[model samples]
Target chain A: MVRFENVGMRYGLGPEVLRDISFHLQPGSFHFLTGPTGAGKSSLLKLLALSHRPSRGLITLFNKEVSSLARDDLPAMRRKIGVVFQDFRLLDHLSALENVALPLKIAGAKNSQIYQHVAELLEWVGLGRQVDAKPPTLSGGEKQRVAIARAVINRPQLLIADEPTGSMDAEMGLRLMYLFQELNKIGTTVVVATHDLGLIKRFGNPVMFLKDGMLTTRKQDELPSQFSRDGG
Target chain B: MMQIIGKSAELQLEKDVSTRYLPVVIAAMIFLAALAIGGLFSLSNAISDWSATLTGNLTVEIAFDPTADLDKKVTDAVELLSKTPGVAAARAIEQEETLKLLEPFLGRNAALGDLPIPRLIEVIIDEDSAIDLAALNEKLGEAVAGARLDIHRPWLDKMVLLGRSVQILAAAIMLLIGAVTVIIVIFAVRTGLIMHAEVIQVLHLIGARDQYIAEQFQNYFARLSFLGALPGLIVAIIVMFIFNFLVGSLEASMLPPLSLGVEGIIALLLLPLMVALLTRFTVRRVVLGSLERMM
Candidate 1:
């Protein structure tokens, strides 16, 4: 469902932050992307989420080449791929329910249909009681849940999470990982970017390790048992 | 809560400090614009009135001479003018009436009868007939000594020219107001975009179309312009009415009252809506263009 061949990226004439990054994942396959700080993990995720263009090489998402896609077609492609930001980019003024309902509302779904589905999803994400709570009023974990709900609201064909468990407790992190697993089981391709080795080992998904603007794919068992929090 | 004009729901633009005073700026711009419109339309109507009243009308002035019988001269001039074809009617203006016309300039205290003043005759020409004013003037001068035909053409021409110049100036002021308003709105919208850039990126990544984001900015700014235009328009109308009242109170005022006919009234009423639409279109273009540079 996703492919990247020798993709190189830089920011506005800067040196390449990601270089010669080549990888591919079959439909419904899940992968963990791990790298040290400044190793371009977020940049790679950005390319996958259709947030930025690769400076060189090919990126195919859902069988269509990304570079060749028209700007007008980007939104529809974006709608099919869900992204959970590392910062949990939920609008602070919006209630949890409203934040979750954004994708549906933007897609022009009827009001009644939007609220009903958003309420159900918020409940599933354990935010039913906090549905009316704004992001500022919610705890970090609660905010993360709201962001996750927003991402999955549209039942996107691909789901990408950047440090999905970074702000949550260990148990909460495990639960959210299980949620990702459940989504993956239903034919949604999942790529989770994290520096947490323990989570990587526990999930035991295929690994795409990035370092110094380069990428390497390996089985989860091939990962070192210990590594610094910075991915050293 | 009441929905404000052009509220950006997703961006929460209603809370931005950057655009908080946009309505006030728009109000000031619209105020000047409305006054310009008032002057433009008022001058147009006044010019039409002057042309209508002066056309086909002539004035005959018989120069005063102490040795001449002014009454007999007036009687002969009236008879000759009446006998001429294309002359509707000719009546000698009474000496008392002529003195009354000079009352404002000469003052009521003057001994008007002792003063040497020209005797004037009013001439009405047939609407359908073409009279050679130059030929008629020569005939009147030959028949009665020192009699002259004054069609008021030169004076009316100068007045019309002055009126038209003022109209052009008013139109230029209107165009300047419109340009200033657009620039102000452009700056305000750009600031709003910058302030809300993070949220905009979030929206875009979440699959919100550029048009969806643009709609919020357009709607919010349009509302500001509309609300601002209303008070400006209201104040202009009030000022116009007060000016007309002051003009009407004068005994022999040369100033005409502000009288906007049907077209002017309709234009005044549509100012708010037109400004709102302009704001909408401008905001949309700026936002969509800015968004195009994004992913």
Candidate 2:
């Protein structure tokens, strides 16, 4: 769960990027964050991901006031939140399996558990045969799946994806969206930042729209749930 | 077929430009440092050997003698010193041997025809001898005119001072090299961090601890330090052995052969381990501090 009230953010003496902003995300709620380019979508995601502090106002994550938390305690809090980057930030030197297993390793999971879970997740993401492939050798969609598997491998309480479907084909994108839906069904709060309106309309989730750093929430006009595998 | 359990963080940095060059830098630094330390130890050992030989020697020289025959004056001095209670043995040095001792101040082939030279008598003192110096001088002057007792304190003090200065200078040089090594490692670590910044952001989002990120850098550098320092130490050992061999090959009596004692050799042998530890600590501190600032 994330709550921001009157939050204003800027990068070091610059004009505020997000001004007088406020929103609260309920536990297990799924929302699509929509904005045009440079609409501070990534910046908003950054703040939610605990990467940056709000320059003004109170920001809370999982009931703990983030701005008041000590810097050392941030990492433990972060392990509960998983992020899929727009660039598919899988380590270039690591294989698909290793990349997916990274969060589990960081969490100090046993070797057998990591191998079994990571292998099963990678297979589910359509990377079953490319487990040993490094990121450089993998296609864009393959790398995206690897990144997504890495994000959800730990089953973090909060799952965030930036442009999760950007580099993938329609079938794979819908499948991945269902994956997110399936995760949300199991009680993981999801906030996906994207400009993909077709996927947004098809999935028909509640939308959080941001323009000029101000945010508004809306429930999408319900569409046919053809791509919805989890029956939202 | 990789046998290792999982990829370590260091491998993440394996391709960076700065990381690629780190091993060579560490090797070169350790090489030079080992040679300096080895040279210092050799000098100390040589000085100790010299001190052991030079001390416990009492020399009796004829300051002035009424008799014109230098040989007769040397003979009387030797006889009186031989009878002295604390004297173990006294012998008159031959004129040629006396001239050989003067060969450094006087030219090697300089004519010795009219050169006024004092008669020299070497006195070997008993190990437990408790002879009173004033009494010995009085007895020597009475028995053999103008006989002077030389304790060689000035020469011994100079040797000790020279030994101490070389040790201090070598130590200072090592410290300076160590400081430079730390600086180089710091720069390397910073550059490595820059190279891995993108990956680090992802890792950070995944809740990787600062220590987890730092260990990747630390392990890489520590390995480089060890790998680099071993060859450097080996090269130093070989070069020093060759240098000592060359000195020994000269068969020169005046120049002592360079060699390290057991302790010095052990220290030199441990250079790889020491460098590894230094690299690990330096990298860990720099990386943690840098990450703390960045985060």
Please name the candidate that would achieve the greatest lDDT relative to the true structure: 1
Among all windows of ten consecutive residues in candidate 1 chain B, which has the lowest summed lDDT? Answer: B1-10
Off by over 4 Å in 1: A229-231, B1-6, B62-88, B103-118, B125-147
Return the DockQ of model 2. Answer: 0.59
What TM-score does chain B of candidate 1 reach? 0.85
TM-score of chain B of each: 0.85, 0.80
lDDT of 2 by residue, B69-142 (tens): 66677888887888889788998878789888889888898997457777778888787768786788888888
Q: Is the docking of candidate 2 incorrect, acceptable, medium or high quality?
A: medium
Model 2 ranges off by over 4 Å: A219-232, B1-11, B67-119, B125-145, B251-254
Error of 2 at B108 (Å): 12
Residue range A70-121, candidate 1, lDDT tens digits: 9999999999999999999998888899999999999899999999999998
**Residue pairs with clashing backbones, model 1:** B6-B219, B6-B220
Can you tell me the CAPRI class of model 1?
medium
